[model samples]
Target: MELITNPQPLQWPTLLKRPIFDNAEIQQRVMPILQEVAKRGDEAIRHYTQLFDKVTLNAFQVSEEEMAEAQRLVPETLQQAIAQAKRNIELFHTAQYDAEKQIETMPDVICWRKSVGIEKVGLYIPGGTAPLFSTVLMLGVPAQIAGCQEIILCTPADQYGKVNPAILFTAHLVGIQKIYKIGGAQAIAAMAYGTATIPKVHKIFGPGNQYVTAAKQLVSQTGTAIDMPAGPSEVLIIADHTANAKFVAADLLSQAEHGTDSQVILLTTHAPLANAVNAEIARQLETLPRKSIAEKALENSKIIVLPDTETAMAMSNVYAPEHLILAVEDPDALGEKVINAGSVFLGHYTPESAGDYASGTNHTLPTNGYAKAYSGVSLDSFVRKITFQHISKQGLKNIGLTISTMAEAEQLRAHAAAVYVRLEE
Candidate 1:
């Protein structure tokens, strides 16, 4: 990692910029796939599956027999682990459920908001370099908690034309039965515009490669809702002398291993700790299976030596990382100043991996500086909050004049007359 010492605030933006890409080119490539899916439906899906995934499939949906075989294929220990993670996820997301409470904004006027789940939703699981079975729990638990009427899953099949066993097991665990053997931009298109076998969804959720991301963006333009704009995974760690160098190195490498485009940053008050962490990263990198991927990601990453914690934090807020780790002496105190970040890991013991896997928080988060505006997926992501209001005769009389007067001032005669008619009734 490159080491820079106390750079000027003006230079922070250049130093912190994420690796750039030609999104227009990716969208240009993805558009034809979407158009084909819309025009030809299942035939388009089959053609793309053969072209991209290199598999010819007779059927797209996973049958009961395939689900049973997948269950048996997953190790018993993994099943237990998945179950434990599911419970924790359920516990955290279930607590987010809000009971409807009516409020009297004025006398005899009652108003309240209720959460209604999107009737149909689709989840895409990437099965290229990594299977990301943990994501199944992240998305499925919340969708179930939100009471979505119909839930379907799409994952790319391997060269041998089989979905990941762990993915299927986890989906079955969450009560999702509609599993499809589809992948990439074609999967997004199938969900966005219904094929003969794959039903269209109200919203599409999950992270994928550049093509998949582009496909989601294209579909969203045509009226399908997507979770958020996402990119390569990233993490930022703010550490000082108090942080363990080995642990910090491991955390940084964890995200770095995600992909070549992934970036990790370190902001520190102590220069010695920065060196120590780099040394630890080099040592740990040798043992990792994805060391090549991590090494490439580290090329895009760096360690910055700041004058103090305040300056480090200010830089972090500007970067607005998808994952932020406060590895300082007083994490809680520093946490109060955090205005931007998709998810935060506080103190020495807490690691970003915990949230990615078993810990209750959803791992599907906003990336590429989007944390400034977007939030990580939660129960609310799966449900829409619909607000309702009721007004009695006396309540209309109390508020009618204010409404009519505002309408009249705006030259909206019909709006004023609607209030006047209610008043007369």
Candidate 2:
């Protein structure tokens, strides 16, 4: 990791820029795949699945037999672990449910909003270098809670033409039956524009590689709703003299291992602590299985020695990391200063992995400075709030002039006439 000391605020933007691919190029490459899927349907899916995943499948949907086999293959201990995680995710998301409350603007005008689940939604789980089984709980639990009519999942099959057993097992645990053996941009296209076998969805969720991210963005333009614009996973840690070097090193490496493009940052007031954490990262990097990947990510990562906590916090807000860890002496006080972040880990004990797995928070978050605007996925992501209003004759008499006058001021005669007609009735 590069170490810089007391850089000016003018240099911060250039210093903190994420390694991002050219959007035009990515979108250019992803467009043809989407067009083919829309033009040819399941045949196109089969072709791309072979081209990208190197797996040829006769059928796209996972059968009851495959699901049963996956259940048998998953160990009891792992199944229990998944169950526990599911319960935690369910509890956290279930609490987000809001009861409808009617508000009266005037004499008899009653208005309220009700959340309705998107009837059909698709979840894309990446099964390439890592099979994110934990994501199944993060997305599936909320979709179920939101009462989505149909939930379809798409994941790539391995060279052996089989979906990951853990992925299948977790999907079954969450009551999702429509599983497809598809991957990459093809999977996004299939969900966005329905193929013969895979049904089109009202909205799509989950995270993936650059191609998958671009595919989601491309499809969204044509009217399919996507969860959010996402990129490589990232984390920013604000450490102090009281912070543990070992713990900080571990936290940084955890995100670094996500992908070669994933970046981790450390902002600290203590220069000695930065050196200690750097040494710890080098020591710990040797044992990791994804050591090569993390090493490449570290080339883009940084450890900057700032003047104080206030400067560090301001820098972090500009970066707006997907995950922010406050490894300070008084985390509670520092945490209050956080205005932008997808998810926050409050102390040394609160590692980002806890929220990624069983802590009941959704791990599907915005990346590449998007945390400044976007929020991580939650129960609300799966549902749309529809508002309804009821107005009595007396209520129309009271509010009609206000509406008509505003409509006339805006020069929308039709809108004013509509209100006048109601009042006349």
lDDT tens digits, residue span 1-425, model 1:
99999999999999998874788998999999999999999999999999998999999998899999999999999999999999999999999999999999999889999999999999988887799999899999999999999999999998888899999999999999999999999999999999889999999999887888889989999999999877689999999889999999999999999989898999999999988999999999999999999999999999999988889999999999999999999999999989889999999999999999998999999888989999988999999999999999999998889899999999999999998998887
Clashing pairs in 2: none
Residue clash pairs of candidate 1 = none
Prediction 1 global C-alpha lDDT: 0.93
lDDT of 1 at 86: 97
**Alpha carbon lDDT of each predicted model:** 0.93, 0.93
Candidate 2 lDDT, 316-401, residue by residue in tens: 99999999999998889988999889999998899999998998989999998889999999999999999999998888888889
Q: What is the TM-score of each candidate against the true structure?
A: 0.97, 0.97
What range of 10 consecutive residues in model 2 has the weakest lDDT sum? 416-425
Runs of candidate 1 exceeding 4 Å displacement: none
